[model samples]
Target: MSGALQPPSRSGVRIAGDLYQWLVAWHGCVTVLRDQTLRPANPIVAIGVEADGAGNLDDVIFYRAQPPNSYEQVKYAVDSATPVNEDYLLSPSPTGGPSILAKIAAAWRSLTASGSQVDLALVTNRHPDPGDPLIRDRDSRTQLLLPKAGVHGPRSDRGKARQRWAVGAGVSEQELLELLGVLRFDLGRDPQHLRELVQLLMLAAGLRYEDHAIDAGADWVARMVRDGYKTLSLDLIEKAVQDLDLKQGPARAVLSIATLKPDPVADQADWSLDWTDRFDGATAYSKRRPKAPATWAQLQADIEAAPMFLRGKTDIAVTGSLRQAPAFCTGAAFRMVSGADLAILQRGQVWSTSADYEAATPAIVEHSLGQGPDLAVAIAVATDPTTDILRYLRDQQLSVGSLLVLAPPAGGAKDNSIPDASTANALAVGIRDAVRETVRTAPHVHLFLAGPLGLALLLGHRWNRIRPTTVYEDVATADFYEPAFFIDA
Candidate 1:
């Protein structure tokens, strides 16, 4: 799955390497499509794979006949921390073939023999060694070698290094300079980030970003490569996309608020908020709570800043271990009035909140604790926290007239009760509707939610026509619940 986290140096090197190559090609292919949002103005017009005739490299990017065709050498590294230093580039392959830098220089020397415009790229998921002078001297973005002064002077360390590289490539300093002049060291994102980027590209191209669709695309690309398909064009790619049924409806980029340990899977989210610092990890799957109530305010500010910076991209898929009042506040932050498409990735499935129109209306159960000016609504959609809610109420001495306990029709609500987005949205809206009736009577309401984060978010999204609500979180402890965000809308 493109949305899942890939293994770190897992077994089956052949398949993994091949898949990485295809992913690179597919990314290029998607961006090169006309009018694609991610597309550059001068996108590579065509792609080549194992194209010895086209160019002696792993892949090739052919531009219109004018000049400067790009030859790429794709390197897939199993170890992410491994750096591409002088020793690594100078070292020969297992079969004692020429070193990577030598081969690249040799090809560069050959192609530019006629003085035709050309460029070489070493595309990989590895970074250059910052400590090594040669690799560090080059620009990170341009990847062009820029030796320091006195580099060419005899006996200088940089000079000796340059001489070693020039001798290794069977070329003079001038010849090496020519190669460096046009070379680009394109250090791409790591495996998981790369796949998420690919998915976003697919979404931008009206192509499906679902796991099945991406898998099918990968399989198709692998088959295409095996079949020796060279000179790939847009027409051919469009046909492949159509034949593979990769077309999809409109959608905006997803902003994932990973409040837990990072999302473990490859989700098709473009922007991400990694809030792993908020919690201490118990295991790979379990996490502890935030240290303080101010953390909630900081979280709200963080959530509030997302839409402000995202500009035209607000439609999103919410996921992660963020739950309860925090989740509800997330929905409240990007609420119903935003008019953005919203979905939740929960428990390996994606449920859209917009499907509530066809959902079964859930029954709401309300209670009157006492007569006061304020209201406290305790929802037990995923679990019951009535006892704790009462404890917090008594401890805080909130002037609450009534306490409304909202649940599903069976008078029971747990994580599994709300099966789909439709039911979840219905239940969320039902709770909101039930709260609206009390909003007219009470000047303020204290909202305490206990449910799946998805349900809380949905309720918050539809939470309009409500009172000045102070949403609470069980941050300190279950017995020590505290107020978090004081949302007026």
Candidate 2:
């Protein structure tokens, strides 16, 4: 019941895929080395490549002695010209077996039959085509297949695709959900991009970030795999590092802070400030400064201690979401004057204080809120914070003399608005400059920001010559405001 077409078997494609697998494995080791929490005190761990007994997702495994290991399947394509549409996933594999998608699901079913905590990912260079309906149902955020459903019946195309996939995998609709839930499609990272990321991770881990270092590592990994080694332990890794001339340099400590959502790069961090529990958008969490002085004091104590705790570390990788005040406070903690190098994850890429670029900044617009010592400024980059900021101010009856708005595209930035790292830095610089000029006379600044984490990190990195600022968080249903951390002095 399959099509007649088949791919021509080639060794080069296979070799390239093998190299990618090694690179992925290399990156995993580097990731664990960079994060303290990722490695346990017991230290019974290793990175798995081509896990010998595990047939399904044995490509790259973040293995512990027991369960909860992250499993990834590498699907490398030499030619990424064609996107992985529904047809591609639904088609029979070149091995003349089940459809690619069905096979993936089947592998999940088989792997999870033993009740092991398994997370599966299909890592590929091919992207999902927007033109395909099934592809549209793939949520990029979670990388899960979310099929469109109809009120009375199944949805036209995507729904049908879902149904077909379920039937093909011998699973019911609900079972399909369970299968899709644990499965993530990690697409669009080509060989070169992966290599670059590997190099960057190496550099961040204080390793000798050279192509030759990687080449030596890759050679060691290939030999290990060929000789039937399943997992590479820390001792083995360090031995390779010593044997292959992989020098250890000055390492950069990583900090992860989250609110709205969990930080994606949290796994690669050393220190973490998790306030996601306080993200209840109701109860003025977004508007007014907390009435209790101790609240701000405690938050500041933690934020201030973070830098001192990481005192001697030459660099820091800031990951996670910090609203306005917390971002600035964190930034101010690791300010430029401290001679601390910093880099933040924006969208998906890394924007660093080490890197500089010239790009167009958002147009600054000033608005008068009221006559008071408190001066409000909204950095409206991703979405317009004006409406929400105004609502919070009115509901809380806060006094504001001025509200400066950093408008990215006048109305608001769309999905493609801050497309690159340079643009993100530009916006942050623009907003920081605006604050520098505006906060000269104001004693207390009410800051409201709507932008990516990178901008927030960047703004705080250079948060100089600004007054003591109170950042507000918006609790959705409450329609009130709660002042978060009061940043700066």
Candidate 3:
């Protein structure tokens, strides 16, 4: 939706709505093909044929054997526009002859005559029509009782047209009635469905649009269709980049054909996505990185693999220099693991919080504000006194037990300094045993973490494994803390 489109003049803006409407219908059919249950039944082999774009039908869904698959026409009308109704079934178009109803009949007839079975669907973005023949389907009825007049028993010119359509399709009135059973009318009023479409398109496009621009995904699809693409492809996004016309900038640029140099270290990562908290705080740190392939196929795969909700029990890592670690964790920590990246990380260790660990924790500490019936233990793992945070929790009246594990007395200098991985492992073991000793007396644990990043990661990794825990980081402002973003079990 953020990508460029043809210049937006007054006319283009007006036409955009209509184009988007058609795209919605078209994408609707494409979605059906993606559904495992519906696709196995409908089995769309080809779609959006040349005849469809020429206005013969909005789309022709093909099947393995023949004609009785499906023909769909998607229509949209704004508040001021005319609503779609059964009248279109018999009415004549501006070019004369039969209207939408006649055309659908003709397509059905043609496909049936060719030894195919087909059904007609009129998908509309308008309000549900009470008078619609298919309204009974809304009542959860499995079958539609065919009416005698407009569809099957018309005696006038409209009836004559159906007769002609029947003859052209080589099907009798009874066969037509049987086909009518498959006729569908999908009224579009559910905002949830529209949201799903927007999400699906985001997966297909591999780009995040502003919330207001979700509907614009359809417009992008329509552009791909209008550009003479017969089938949807992941490459259309790249073409969109080339076709973009930025009216508010330099209109022309000098062009020189040149060969691009290959990267010395090719990036193997294929996709990217992020999750945020209600406060507009990102789970991961804000940092720039090399781009990955921005293709729809990869995006779709990524969306399918995304966790439905961030789970509880996770880990976070912070650099030692990030003195205000909790605040950084609040807005800057992130975890993004792609199919390729996951493979690499499993084979080795990678130490960047922004890219590898954004999805590992809850985005904010407020997620635990009222998350208690059980008593909580606030454990501060640091060298110095954590009285500020402890006092703040007490002042806030969060009923919880508290413990402070000060640096060991008469310990080695490394005990006070940042510990290495092995030392962090030993420290993590000690912390886990202490927590195990405490949780037996309490029900839950809320952590106030200090000390080195290695220690934090090691402790978090182990604690999260033991049980789901709430981990907090210290922010810059006095007496404030933010939750670490590691909530998975």
Candidate 4:
């Protein structure tokens, strides 16, 4: 039954390919826990599949002993049209000539014999259809496991597809109905939904760093699978809860990429920027950490001592605090008259921008630098206080074939600390629409996005729906922007 599975696509692949399997296992465990009859008794002895080599009976969430409380068979399909038919359950294997339905029947019999209620779930990435197969809606999915009855009698009498499986398993229609539950995941077409589900699983696993969440969650799933449980369920949860709950740590503050300076070791011949520094000097100032500048003069000394590089034309800004302040203190001001362009990156009085900087609203400026391979899209929000970067791109003749500028809407608040989600979403939608319109005419569009890191991440999350897009990190004094990562949608 598994041999016919097709390979996954090259693009739009999951970050860690098997995350879907782990998600299926987690959903099964969650389903069993939500069952009041089984949950209150604390009778769930273990929740895992039998690690016996065959890999037949998968996603087992056991309750109190001999038989499992729930048994789920997971299938992650790349195609949305894949069907869940009677043959999938009834087709016999060559060696033992036993079908999945027979195995499910045996499991139900064992559970019933042990006086435990049965909860069987068939989980798949595609929506199932047993009769008049389709992938559109829930109704079609319902028809897969439970066909509508005809007027003359029951649907089974009318030759419903599930009836064939019942006959093949030597079980009555009522018994089959009592044992089975259909759980479908339509993940193939909706990439955003899939990403959100994966993100939710990561959050449930207690990972807060959005960038690191998937990798960490994948590792958690891997540990569960490695320790003899072919599934991730309540057993893994119990373990996560036991070890002083190492999985649950205090969330670390998310530092913006702008808060750190880039590596100073670039060759004079190379103009490319690179962000290889380990610490955010901006954050260091706010926390009053040792070696943090306590005054504007000290900060100036630090900046003067800091390495500077010649750039082709990328505008730069320094963001963060000058001294240790209370968590809520936002009115402190810090400024330094330096030979190089320097600005303190903070909200309120700590505010400073490249000399005589004025905020500009949402506008798109396209430069025709001839038909070159390079395309640059600079995104500037009002909060970042560096919209001048757009102007810089507008002026530069860096063989950039086209330039797309995203600025705040007119009369919008500029230099706000954190851009609100609603505004961010609206801005992202506008930008996505603009990019779609632009890409139709301007193919092979490369990106040189500059904005708050939070907005960068949000853009990354949404733009993953687009083609392979590169994100660049601003290296303060570097000649050119650094290519940080690519979003291969």
Candidate 5:
């Protein structure tokens, strides 16, 4: 919780106070047009100009700011050579010339001022199919009109062939400059004697297409830099540098890792039983009654009195070593159970230390299953302990249908801490082997691992055939929910 959460700054751009005021005013108009419906088609046009040698101004790109119909038409024009009517033009001025009225008119034309042409088009339709006709290739030509130069052929004033296109009729220089200003501001430029400002207007408003905007801004800056526009005011550059440095801050946190276990009673259920009449009957003797109230001891005693049907059932025994006893005990004692029933057979006898648990688990499992309990569902819990026990269990040549070994969680108790990669790999290999062995003998034997460690243990081993049908969240708060869980199918 000690990480820096810096708000975006706007320390990019250098201009006179009056020009700044004009920019602010123009931006207001741009914002209004971008947010609200005004023009039915081509409400706004963003123009970018790249002047080339011979003052030819080779690049003149125009984007439709709003309305699906216009956006599509403009996109078609840019992507292909599709001719779009003048009415659909978003460019503030088609002539590539300056005009205060034109800028004002253009400002009044749109709402959100900053966005890519593609993003603006997408706004009109989300979830467009990838194979849609709009995405298909089309045969067309790309062209841009330039100012008419001196007459080339003879009969300059006599007969002449009408040109198919006209220059300075589709875009203007003023619109281009305004767009460049917007791009520079977005890329972090600042004025003198003020805190560096990184424009977060788009982010603040929860706008999308951030990558598109950044890319476009970078492209424009690179173009400007290449074109000898490197005389940026020192103050503006300094402010931008300062703003970036401040944004790249540091973080702090109190971090620790811990392992955990599931509740023994629920997890160790010999047979899965639903909470229904049958279960109630089996556990009825211990239920508190109006005539004969029962105590905790009575309830436990009643549960033991009920006949267990685990006799002759196929058994899968899982075993492992524990590196830490108290941690393992804390995890196992409190771990929640699912799809199984757990009951503490002898709480007083269960050891809560690594060495003791390792020494006692086998005997506890063996002793608890009096008369062999027909089959054993053993889960071995371990914390960075030697795999010698795992190897020994494997060497016993127990049928795969009767063995499952899982690794302990990496962290002792802290959240988001998983087992290390190496430990996870070893556990996975062990689990896979166990699963294969089990399936070979008892094909229908259901297999499961306890924690993330357990899951990784199996997965790392590539036991693709043994997938967990359910997961047990011992610490609900610490388990990260997959995004798919929240997605509506």
Candidate 6:
């Protein structure tokens, strides 16, 4: 069966519209698998029919089956028919009437004789809901029936309704074969054509730049390049146009850009030659090649005015002679600079805030601090640490006396566990143990845990002997708070 299908106009309607067009274009191809006499041993007749339970075909069920029966005995002998065809006993039904069981039997026999299996598959955007009957007859005939009246109503959403529809369908073996044959024939043509149809629908719906278009362009370009078009030239352009039959404007531009070539003259001019004088006994000239070499100053004076000594301008000097010390030399020089010297140099350096060096100073200071043992042992985390926060701490240039910060993971929920009474007690014990270990190894060492509840817990305990300080959460964001430790002040 064939009919004109209309394109969808609504938003999100591209998929449906493209599917409809594909069914229409390949309507005749539904019989591809139906050719039994062929070597491949495919099916005979294929039909795609869709019903929405409202007595209307809402979709197409593509299938493959055998040819129509010719004799009455053949039809009657077919035992696996969904329903026994009684057309042999009775007169043929009116035109366009329901097919009798005998006809179905004949189709089955034809399929079996052809040595072809019934292949059936469904292609639907919406999935059938659970508990749907999805019924099929013994002969592989299928019909999707919607739920009876009042079974689904206004309360049901689109998803639920689709599920209900799927549950009501009944499919038979013969019908399934028919459905799949139709689908295989249609789908086997070319995936790109189906994609193009979908893209056209998307373009009509104002959904330009959809994945299909982007992918199609990329794939097409890749294929063209792989097909031996090394560079885009007039010959290549003409060949592409003749081979692909592409139109002159946009298509031509695409091919041209895909095979574009670099300028040969510009590439040749990128390198230059250099000239240098070699000293030796005899007068001679030697040429040496150099890449991107510099030009030498011209000898403006006349040749007659030039005086020739013992050594020739182009002679190669011996290695030992070249290593000899010069007749005249300069004095040896040395200078020492320290942190104070660097500070003086920094004072003299015209530091502009907009310059990159000015921005790098804090990083240099942090590097200096990080080199120390105390700061290296400090573990830190930020709730939502930012570059500015890190930069501020680094600017302090302090060798921190053991600090720890905690922050949430990226893109995670910010619901960090606040230390309760039990948690606080456990943390206090752990901190005490860590402090004792540090004291045994190196006395006067300070430990700090900075967080909202950590600070509160430490303050409540008044752990003066432990040398532990609790810093508030906002202290992390405060630029005025330096990283250095304070003693009792």
Overall lDDT per candidate, in order of appearance: 0.71, 0.70, 0.40, 0.42, 0.25, 0.25
lDDT of 6: 0.25
Q: Write model 4 residue lDDT over 1-489, tens digit each, in one string.
A: 778866666554553335665654443343333332223333444456543422344544444443434555555555656465555557786576778677767666654665655555555555445353222223322322333331134443344644665687778866665554432222232333344443332322333324344444445655778776554455565455354233443211111121122211121111222221233344332322223223323332333222333222122222222221111011111111122222222211111122232232355666555645556676655433234444445455444566776666653335462345445445655666677766664435456544443344334434533445554444443334434344443
The total of clashing pairs for model 4 equals 5
4 or 6, greater by TM-score: 4
Tens digit per residue, CA lDDT, model 5, 304-402: 222233332221111121112111222222222211111111111111111111111111112121221112122334332123323323454333323
Say what the RMSD of model 3 is.
18.0
Top candidate by TM-score = 1
Q: Where in model 5 is the C-alpha error above 4 Å?
A: 1-405, 408-423, 437-443, 448-450, 453-461, 464-489
- Ranked candidates (TM-score, high to low): 1, 2, 4, 3, 5, 6
Error of 3 at 397 (Å): 23
- The collision pairs in model 1 are 3-266, 4-266, 370-401, 372-401
List TM-score per model, in order: 0.61, 0.60, 0.39, 0.40, 0.22, 0.19
> Which is the winner by lDDT between candidate 2 and candidate 6?
2
Tell me the lDDT of candidate 4: 0.42
Model 1 gets an lDDT of: 0.71
Runs with alpha carbons beyond 4 Å of true place in candidate 3: 1-14, 25-46, 49-55, 59-70, 80-99, 130-136, 139-176, 189-198, 201-489
Each candidate: RMSD: 8.5, 9.2, 18.0, 21.1, 26.1, 32.2
Mind giving the per-residue lDDT tens digits that candidate 1 earns over 1-489?
Answer: 779977654466766777888887777676555334434445566677777643346464645335777778888887766687788788887799998888888788777778888877887888878787677776542456753512557577777777888888778877777677787776645676667656655654567777777677777777887787866777777788889888876645556676655553223335567666665454424443554443767877888777775677656666555757767877887788888666665554455666645444455656666757898998887877787888778777789977888887667767788777677777787788888876797989899888877788888888888988899877545456777788886
Query: What does candidate 6's lDDT look like per residue over 333-419, in tens digits?
Result: 000110000000011121111112111000001223342234211212213333344454467544444333222222221324322
* Worst window of 10 by summed lDDT in candidate 3: 250-259
